[model samples]
Target: MSTTTLLRSRPSRPLKGGGVSRTSPLKPRRSRLLTGMMLLYLVYTLVPLLWLLLSATKTQDDLLSSPGLWFGKTFALFSNIQDTLTYDDGIFLRWLGNTLLYVVVGAGGATLLATAAGYGLAKYKFAGRRAVFAVLLGAVAVPGTALAVPTFLMFSNLGLTNTVWAIIIPSLVSPFGLYLMWVYASDAIPHDLLEAARIDGAGEIRIFFTVALRLLVPGVVTVLLFAVVATWNNYFLPLIMLSKPNLYPLTVGLTQWSNQATGVGARPIYNLVITGSLLTIVPLVIAFLFLQRFWQSGLSAGSVKQ
Candidate 1:
């Protein structure tokens, strides 16, 4: 075979109406309007955070005197932190401990329950499964606030009001977490894999632990983060349930500090309040940073079919 004959016999590429090559790749056009809007949004989001960071470093007078985006003359950040920790007999530390306790027990329990329930719902076939799903959807739609009054009344009847159980108990029920895990598990864990484990004399529980659990890591982490954030940021439920100042979480405790600025004989602790608010969000930021990879994977899992 000659080179000329080989070249002449090769297939020709198709063209569009005006003879433009169909196989040619076109670069995506960038929209300046969208880029400018995004820049504006970035400024809007960062400005508040910058203001908070700068404000937390100032004394009460300096906070009021200094421009929001700029630092004050005397940097009192360390002193402000000391004051926040030591003020009112170190109640901030107590609130911190309480918040940790709630997050660990409530959020942790919620995740465990959600994982198990979601996995079971995804894999198992039993009576009333559709009903269970319907109930879950209904529960998810009903905001927590709507259930608060009834929950309070029930807790009051049981003499459980103002106790840690009041907060921890309610935090364990995460309908959204369950729903998310169910959806993730249905696709992520193959039915054939589970059946193979069973054929090899592995019990259902053993199979789930050794086989399905590994595939469910991203989904589990995603549910856990959601539960953690929800339980950590819970405000109204704890506010209405617990009247004891010592039992308060950081959310309610910080609000109390913020309110000290108003009314007669008010002691304005703006410096501590600002500093405390900064402290409050640090753990959440850390959580997102650490678990972000798993979170992103979980979100994108079912997007493309294998």
Candidate 2:
């Protein structure tokens, strides 16, 4: 009879106020507003990329006259790509190669050095650690553009200006990346494991490489993405540091060709520029999609024994 009665009774009343909180009244409105804003933001962000994609499909004349949001011709994409490739003795390919090299050399080094330094700052205790961190924080505040002149002069003194090292070396030190690592290491890496590793006779470098680094991968990936993007898009530094046309990265190369497109009666190479720009983004997009796997945090779940 008790079992029958329990089966027949309504489920015990959910604890009154179990779900909604005091702030519940405002939630629907806030959610609606946030949804509206996000929709607007999506349109704003995607609109330009859409424009670029559509524009890349048009000829130079069609691009200027056509409504950018819609397609005028569906099949010009292949022809545009062909022209972009063959344009001006294949300088486009050279520029693409240069950009890739710069990104890999500069951003790659920065990611590694930042990871090591960040891990050390986050996990280790030594004299002047706080002071060193404070200095790094200050370095972040100093704009990269602001230091370009000083950097150029220093590089000039060393005969590094106008060379790949001029850009690559500067990119090796990212204060922002260091700070990110420090923050991530503080919150993400568990200290109990560090003690355990010490108990097992793991040397500092071994523990960091074999344990801490694998755990802090998301933070490392985040910094690497930023560094790669920064190095790829960098224009001002390369402008000041490198003058040789052969040494120009894509940003400078594109700007040079783009400017020449405006030469009197040359008929603007807008189509080529637009098309090339789209192609330039392909490697980065592909890289993000591929390297994202490496960025997963908590991947080292079993590295430190329970």
User: With candidate 1 superimposed using the best TM-score fit, by how many Å does residue 112's alpha carbon deviate from the native?
Assistant: 1.1
Which ranges of candidate 1 are over 4 A from the true structure?
1-33, 304-306
What is the Cα-based TM-score of model 2? 0.81
Instruction: Please provide, for model 2 over 110-200, each residue's C-alpha lDDT reduced to its tens digit, 9 standing for 90 to 100.
Output: 9999889888888889899989977877877888789999989999999999889997888788888887788778777899998899999
TM-scores of the models, in the given order?
A: 0.88, 0.81
RMSD in angstroms between candidate 1 and the native structure over all alpha carbons:
8.8
Put down candidate 1 lDDT per residue, 144-203, tens digits, no spaces: 799999999999999999999999999998888888889888999889998888889999
Give candidate 2 regions above 4 Å deviation: 1-37, 263-267, 289-306
lDDT of 2 at 254: 77
Give residue 52's error in model 1 in angstroms. 0.4
Query: In candidate 2, which residue pairs clash?
Result: none
